[model samples]
Target: MQATNTLPLDMVYHWEATKADSLYLTQPVGNDQVVEYTWGRAVDEARRMASYLKSLNLPEKSRIGLISKNCAHWIMTDWTIWMAGHISVPLYPTLNAETVNYILNHAECDVLFVGKLDDWEMMKPGVPDSVRCISFPLSPPNDFETWDDIIARCSPLEENVQREPEELATIVYTSGSTGKPKGVMLTFLNMAYAAEGGMEVLKVGSDERMLSYLPLAHVFERTFVELASLYAGFHLFFAESLDTFVEDMQRAQPTLFLSVPRLWVKFQQGVLQKLPQKKLDTLLKIPVVNKLIKKKILKGLGLDKVKLAGSGSAPLAGDVLDWYRNLGLELLEGYGMSENFAYSHINKPGRSRTGYVGENMPGVETKISPEGEILIKSPATMLGYYKDEEKTKETFTEDGFLKTGDVGEIDEAGRLRITGRMKEIFKTSKGKYIAPAPIENQLMANQSIEQVCVSGANQTQPFALVQLAEGVRDKVADEAYRKELETTFSQLVDRVNKTVDPHEQLAFIVVMSDEWTIENNFLTPTLKLKRNVVEDTYEGKINDWYAQRKKVIWQ
Candidate 1:
């Protein structure tokens, strides 16, 4: 695999099957017809899109807002916007009405492209009256023109485009942790280098099948799915919906895979539900039953053919990864944040590390500061926050290295292991500090626990608030069943405490039930549990969980 500096120099990476032939995406967009296109045809569509943009008489770098789920049309429209020398602003599909308006307004968007949307009309309140909104629906409404109509009206035109490597490609607004969304400005060169770096690392063959289910609007997916696949000739496919993702994967049989920790846990939970943890533990004690159970679990998930699998966006327990390996799937975890265009580091092919994010991607320099926070310099790093000069300045050092908010250690093998978030660390009255995410992930690895929140604030001992799995509803409600849960939880807590530092051990275990969902504002679009919300919601409920002060709090 070549280094980032030596890989792709252009936005689109393609392959040749015949004369001028290349690979592209195939999918159904919300009951829309299944459609497929060759790379050559897609290029033609993009050029036509650019032609329409050239006729708009807009000034250079005029912002264009594009709100859509992942689709081939999304990429075609994105490339078209860049081809016309305009900036692209992509909105997340799962955003609420407030953020839809916020991103369009913040970007000062002059034109909007709406793609095969869900609940689109209800979301229209966010658009400014002055902004001309166009629809890219598979079947556009009578009032607005479909993308095909717009492309047909404009004559086919290609440009002698001139863009510096440092030119801004798109503005990606991250979900707000404090209040409102902040746009992160990413340059074409910054993104291109990162995609190339990932290609250099994974080295998967161009013929590999990739399922593009994650939101392409995200920097992580855009760099890996949109850009990396283009350069590698991988045939990309999209899911019909979340419920049908597994079906699509079986059809596509994707060789390369990526998912957040929570989704992977859901996959594991589904299997374990069929064969409860107690049954699994019992079977594992007997070698014959253990081998048979592992085989059954792997076959059920269709992971038998999964060439590569990995989880990121949150910490995953080492034990979970080991379990997958025992069943013959080598699940490696990687680490990166939005600022690095989401490709700063990844695990190497054969060399796997438990806590460390793999080595820095090619061309990215990394180091640990005196305080142990990770510092990085890469062409892939975001240029800065959009329209927020002060925040941008605060995010970098005097010499321009992006300050990764994580504390970490670098091992002799060059793998980077994250300890905790700098701001997330909480000090106890006993003068010991704790990072909650790792402890929480470990707790959730227990078969019954779905989500876990750990906080100490001003208290002497830290504790966990965990939600039981939905499938365990029967046991969750039964008092006799509840007793068994308490017993299991107490042992789980004791086992965890012996493994970690005395100060970091969880003192109380609270069994909770309300699911952490996007609809309820408890999870990010990427599915990470909202730490702030968890701490805030459970603050009053803490006493209810701690009232008994037993080893486990089961209500």
Candidate 2:
């Protein structure tokens, strides 16, 4: 395989020949059992599967759909698609049947690979009978062809397969925060550029170990964990389930970790439950005790071996970032989008500044438009949206810069700090426009609040609708605790008000009784709040909430 501008398949071939017996993937089965795959064995399985795919005689570049949680066979199937000269389309495991149907038909999929999933019955109706179905070893009982059965019958593809850098590699659909999701078409070159660049910046190598729990359907994990592993030849581990996540993490002892803000906060809350904040703060002040305490906490969370940890996909609370820093962890924040394959910007190891996303990546240029939208031009920019040429043209400026919908500022040191989304800024009836993201971040600093949405679209003043944290909810049922929380939240609002302009100050906070979750469609699969869904759910009660004129009202 040629090394120049290498694609993922090229690196896969390189590792298979040089490190044939090296362990590449570790997958957890049920009941404390695991299966490991070596480089040679894994490629052999992919080769056999590729031969099976080729027998179908699908048209060149035909779309093949993959629906599964992160598992060993998921990666193998992706490689098989490319080797068979087909494009891959991965759907989020949590997507509803309606969305699954929409995506499969929209992509004109010829075949579907169904792997480990929790809700196969619910999603089964989504797969049109016209499309062929293949099942993985871990898949729920179905009549579809099994991976092991196909491998047993077929011979491995003997010739080394190579893909042109400009060929279509994958189509990733957005999480659909507002409306229908659009397919972002990324080429082999786009993925190669991002994976290679990230590997260089992070200094990853074969010695590095990482846990893959984030959805590979999303660009962030696909580019960093899947594609980067191919480039760097690192050991990758799959998380079994939510119940076994801690055990899985411990088994890997990952040298590199990546997480979203919500999971990071949950880890903090879990630690604080074991040791109260006041007592923990006092212990940390002692020079000798602080080191031991930090070590114990990291070890307990199965992160003692983590050399670098990152948070992305949403704005993390500043207070949460500071908490991790105090524990001697170098937690960095980054900024990117699906249009650029998430290769835009990341903080330098020793040069990171708090609250800023960091400087532009290598070979990337960024500029703030006159309207304050962040525009970026990078080596990994997508070819275009899958089939929407008009929308694709509108997304880019005449100079070829992708228009990121985020409004942000660049400092003198070139660090970028995001303010809010352009479409999320809502105007009140009093003719004042308020950006909700910064205010929501401020609200998240309070440990009692789990999720907050600040909306006052046509009202006189902005207000917050918040779901109380899980640990705090049980206590709120008690009369005494409820009154105490009311007082604490009142003071919290006053503090937040003093920091913002008069119009931006919130009128009150509404404690919601209902939970916001992916199952309820209040949050995207990536855990981002769907503002439109949240606002519409409470539109009829906004006037009632304000009529009480209380500092805090419980819904």
Which candidate leads in TM-score? Answer: 2
Flag regions of model 1 displaced more than 4 Å.
Answer: 1-20, 29-33, 138-142, 160-162, 277-299
The global C-alpha lDDT for each of the candidates, from Candidate 1 onward, is 0.77, 0.91
Alpha-carbon TM-score of each model against the true structure: 0.92, 0.99
Report residue 348 deviation for candidate 1 (angstroms): 1.0
As for candidate 2, its clashing pairs are none
lDDT of 2 by residue, 1-555 (tens): 112378889888999999999999999989999999999989999999999999988999999999999999999999999999999999999999999999999999999999999999999999999999999999999999999999999999888888898899999999979888999999998888888878778888889999999999988898888997889999999999999989999999999999989889889888887797899999999998999999999999998999999988998898998898899888989888888898898988888887889888777889999999999998799988999999899999999999989999999989899999999999999899899999999999998887899999889899998888778888887999999999999999999999999999999999999999998999998899999999998898988888999999999
- The whole-model C-alpha lDDT of candidate 2 against the native structure comes to 0.91
Count clashing residue pairs in model 1.
1
lDDT of 1 by residue, 1-555 (tens): 222343232544223223236557787655545677777777777778889888888989999988878888888888788878888999887788788888988899999888766667666778788787677755235366568888778766644465566788889988645468789998877777887777778876677887887777877788777887777767888877777776777766777777777777778888877877677778878977877777677667756567888777778877777767767678888887778888777877689887667887788788888988899988888889999999999999988889989998889989988888887899987999998878886787787777778897777789988888767755666788888888888898998899889888887887766778876889877777778888887788766655667888754
Q: Estimate candidate 1's alpha-carbon lDDT, on a 0 to 1 scale.
A: 0.77
What 10-residue stretch in candidate 1 is worst by lDDT? 11-20
Say which candidate scores most in lDDT: 2
- For residue 57, give model 1's deviation from the true position in Å: 1.4
